[model samples]
Target: MAKLIMVVEDNDLNRKLFCDVLKAQGFEVKPIADGNEVLSAAREISPDLIIMDIQLPGISGVDLIEAAKKETSLKDIPVLAVTAFAAKGDEEKIREAGAAGYLSKPVSIIPFMNAVKELLPG
Candidate 1:
């Protein structure tokens, strides 16, 4: 079965781009626009991977990642955090929050897919 990836991004364009690319790569994708809905959706779907955007409404991706890591059922799922604000030490902060990987905004297809493949179990 194709791996299921949940994409949690607030930007419509970014979300669409991520979902389109993942779908084209033969992966199943669940696209979400609201930060508030991520946890519930994650728990319900138990996706193989989560593509998280650091800036989101209601809750930040860092907080969500930390929260997910604390959940026994969701801890093992890897999160690939995507952020437009690529400030210094941001990657480290996201990683410290329990993201398995990090990608800056305007992500290239090769690296984006590479990160996804690296995180997902084959």
Candidate 2:
């Protein structure tokens, strides 16, 4: 079966772009536009990987990552943080928050695919 991916992004354009890219890569993509719905949506979707955006409306992506890590069922799933704030120390912050990988926006197709590939088992 194709791997399922959850994209938690507040921006419509970014969310759509991520969904389109993942879909093209043959992934079953679930896009969540609201930060408040992330946990419940994740529970329902049970995605293999989560591509999260940092600057969310309600809960920050970093917080969500930490929360996911604490959950028994969701903890095993890798979370790749995709953020526009590629400023100094942002990558480390995401990593400390328990993200498996980090990708800076605007994400190039190749790099984005590569990141996803790394997270998935062969």
Residue runs of model 2 more than 4 Å from their true location after superposition: none
Model 2: per-residue lDDT, tens digit, 1-122?
99999998988988898899999989999988988888888888889999999988767899999998999888888999999989999999899989999999989999999999999766
Instruction: State, as a TM-score between 0 and 1, how close model 2 is to the true structure.
Output: 0.95
Q: Where does model 1 exceed 4 Å of error?
A: none
Using lDDT, give the best candidate's number.
1
- Cα lDDT for residue 117, model 2? 91
In order, the Cα lDDT scores of the candidates are 0.96, 0.91
lDDT per residue for candidate 1 within 30-111, as digits (tens), equals: 9999999999999999999999999998789999999999999899999999999999999999999999999998899999
